[model samples]
Target: MPTPDATRFTVLDLLDLNLNEQNALNLRCIGGRKGLSREITVPDLNRPGLALSGFYESFAWQRLQIFGRGENAYLKMLAESSNVEIYDKLFSYPIPCCIFTHNLAPSKEFFDAAERGDCPILQTDLSSSEFSSRVLRVLLDIFAPQTTIHGVLVEVYGIGILLTGDSGVGKSETALELIERGHRLVADDVVDIRCVNGSVLMGQGANKVIGHHMEIRGLGIINITHLFGVGAIRDKKQIQLVCGLEEWDANKVYDRIGTEEMTTEILGVHIPKLEIPVKPGRNIPIIIETAAMNERLKKMGYHSAKEFNQNVLRWLESENARALYFNRDDFL
Candidate 1:
């Protein structure tokens, strides 16, 4: 199962905690993660009102990181802190994470203290602005769940082929061919996969933007939905397979028989996987199609190698029986 996004929090966000009288801050203290208490202690700042310090205690900053939107009170409090560099970095960070940086690197003392009940700290070398930008991009990338590349996603037979490589790796070209052969296209370059259950992962694109676009290198962008109509596209499908394209390596050993099944785990879900080396003379699109079809057959209770081995064993037994029973046949 894909791990869901992390639950977020901050020092300022500590107020609305309304924690139980136990005064624990570990996972259990929050009533979400068990035994999470005894990790961090919230000290009494002993101040109130709109001064810089008070804002840190405010609900705004706390809520923003948790909910992905910051409030005013916390912002003002952060500005007032003496740890100017730390304050800037925290403000710049879009996601809520315990930070230990620059002068405030955690000591054995602090680590031991947090183990008992303190916030874990993160250390970074970048300046406030640079760190902030990096953190923001990470946060946005995680939370957005919408930054998608326009391409085609197809479930050929049962194998999910995610055609990706360098530009002009013929990813889209292969997909276009597969689609013409009546295979389903799930998404283009951008595939939105959500873990629906413990082992099932489903893929689809935004409905509003589904089946509508393709990005070709020289042609730039083309609207696939407009040209091909709705039947040419798909909203979503279960991700059961993965086929990655790579430049050919003669020395590399590829799967000669379907005996060894490889899998890739995403978000916690594992799907069967294959790496198809790309080369000039090889017909990749057809090869991918055949792979998908073969996988489908395996799922349908047929093991080609096992069946062949069984036949060979039967032939050997029959020959041995005839040799041993030669006298018995005449006696009977």
Candidate 2:
């Protein structure tokens, strides 16, 4: 699925991405300005070596084409041999763009063909391997299935816990307590979640400007980063657990024993879920903290509730065995 608020992801969107230094693409367009608006539909990439060699049997013309030094060298050979027909044949399909790695430049003839085909040609300074890896990673993140959720995302005890509930269910208040108690807040109110690699859900604030800002019931708005320093806020985190906060009910039965596991689905991926009932003197923040630690223990192969149940079962069996021995005919 596409992100709730985003439109088509074009080549211009990739260029406009504000990535950090380590993951920056450093791409610049050298030709075909009118085709920069072309949409990139796929997450995968193609090297275009086979297409350049006139073997277009299994050509992946829809993906972003990465032309390494070898492909450029072949193109140079083609230019020398006046084999210009292959360029037109290659651009015949609506390829997203042609990316030249290692600061490689295309010949005048190739640029003419790209202009004629209305295909954008991009250039990068990194080597073929490095650029390919970086661009692929970026593309995967962009094309990943995404959706926006109404909740607060926080990191407590090194686990991402999504606090969800009705509008007036004290979800934000509980998250505020969590933040004040030395935990880190990923986002407040609106969380943009993306399912990366089809398994892991990465969550971040919907808007960067107001991501760190939180709106309490009466406090209006407060900046978490400024109030708690930079250590109390993070840009993003994986959604490992979901805890739904609800008003405490007098008649509804709650799960006292944790033998059975519960889960909730988001973006078609399931994660551990807990429904927490809130009332006065409930100490929800501490409970959430403990829940985070318990989740970690579960990941480490320790099940507290299950172990306790097994111990109780063993004790009952021992008691029954003792009663049988004492009441046996031979013993009596």
lDDT (C-alpha, whole model) for all candidates: 0.52, 0.91
lDDT of 1 by residue, 1-332 (tens): 11132344333333223333333222212211222221222211111123223344343332212211122234334444533344343333222234322323432432333333333334434443344444443333333322233334687865666665666677877887787777767777766766553566667664533344667677777776666667766666777777778788899998776577788776776788888889999888899898787777778988776777789899999877887788676545
TM-score of the candidate numbered 1?
Answer: 0.50
TM-score of each: 0.50, 0.94
Candidate 1, residue 11: the lDDT equals: 33
Which runs of model 2 end up more than 4 angstroms from their true locations?
A: 1-5, 325-332
Highest TM-score: give the candidate number: 2
Candidate 2 structure lDDT: 0.91
Residue 63, model 2: lDDT of 93
